[model samples]
Target: MSADTADGDGSEEAVADEETAADDAAADTYTVAVDRDACDGVFACLVRDDRFREDDDGLAGFDPETADALERSEASVQATFTDDRLEDARAAAAACPFDAITVETQ
Candidate 1:
């Protein structure tokens, strides 16, 4: 029943290493959103995540009919996680078919 028991010091180190790597990966990542009023519903971010969605007004606006819908539409499509990817978000804004998406950051 207890045939395999060890100090497990190496396991802790391995977990720490994994956490460090994750932090590094996320360090450059942040959060992004669309202006909705400036979006044209081109859905270029559909490949990134299902969070992005086309506006109901037919102008690529960020529809907020439901919390889940809003979250999904804003999760990946019209949003990003690059701390220094404002340029990338700008490109998305420019790529909008209706020029209705606007990205902002701090």
Candidate 2:
């Protein structure tokens, strides 16, 4: 009557755990980037994704409070997020007039 008994060798539970772990990992890893050189202060990305905000230089940047990691340089800014919001980031990238935004799945 144990849980393992329902699956003989407990392989069912192990398979389920592995699938869940893979799903979690896939759901929680993505990166969003902004090419500062191409950005034109349009703020289109901000409207599509709240995580994107206006930085001091009037370009797209990530909100430190929400982004898991933020990196910046003179030419670009990149943010890593551990959340199920890849579509939101994609929308932001699509909305950019200058094609400055990019989103990649990890």
Candidate 3:
């Protein structure tokens, strides 16, 4: 038996292209977390990852924790990222001498 494939609009290629685009748009997302308890304020994370930076008390990553304590303490600071910045975020996590940074991907 022969396969049956037909498109009245004759835009099969266009349909396939749209599907591919959708897949790309659904790329993985990531989040970064820093534990002030584990951080040493070495600034290694700031140097290694563009997403990280130095704050008043110490190094602060993007999308820091929402808790009011985050201003005084960095125990549970967090950051979110997409495919484009996932690598940078991970690098920052790895650069933490105290292993304060944590990268979570979905």
Q: Count the backbone clashes (under 3 Å) in each candidate.
A: 8, 0, 0
Maximum-TM-score candidate: 2
User: What does each candidate score in C-alpha RMSD?
Assistant: 9.0, 4.6, 6.9
Candidate 1's C-alpha runs over 4 A off are 1-30, 61-106
- Per-prediction TM-score to the true structure, in the order listed: 0.35, 0.75, 0.60
| 23-80: candidate 3 lDDT, tens digit per residue | 7865557667788677777878877776566667755645343221223333666655
Q: Which ranges of candidate 2 are over 4 A from the true structure?
A: 1-26
Q: Rank the candidates by TM-score, best first.
A: 2, 3, 1
Candidate 1: tens digits of C-alpha lDDT, residues 10-77: 88779889998976654353334565545555577543333345555543433343212233344233
Cα lDDT of model 2 by residue, 1-106, tens digit = 4564654778789989999997777576888999999999999898989988899988889899998889999999999998888889999999898999888887
Native-referenced Cα lDDT, model 3: 0.66
- Full candidate order by lDDT, most accurate first: 2, 3, 1
Global CA lDDT computed for model 1 = 0.49
Scored against the true structure, residue 91 in model 2 reaches a CA lDDT of 93
> Model 2 scores what on Cα lDDT?
0.88
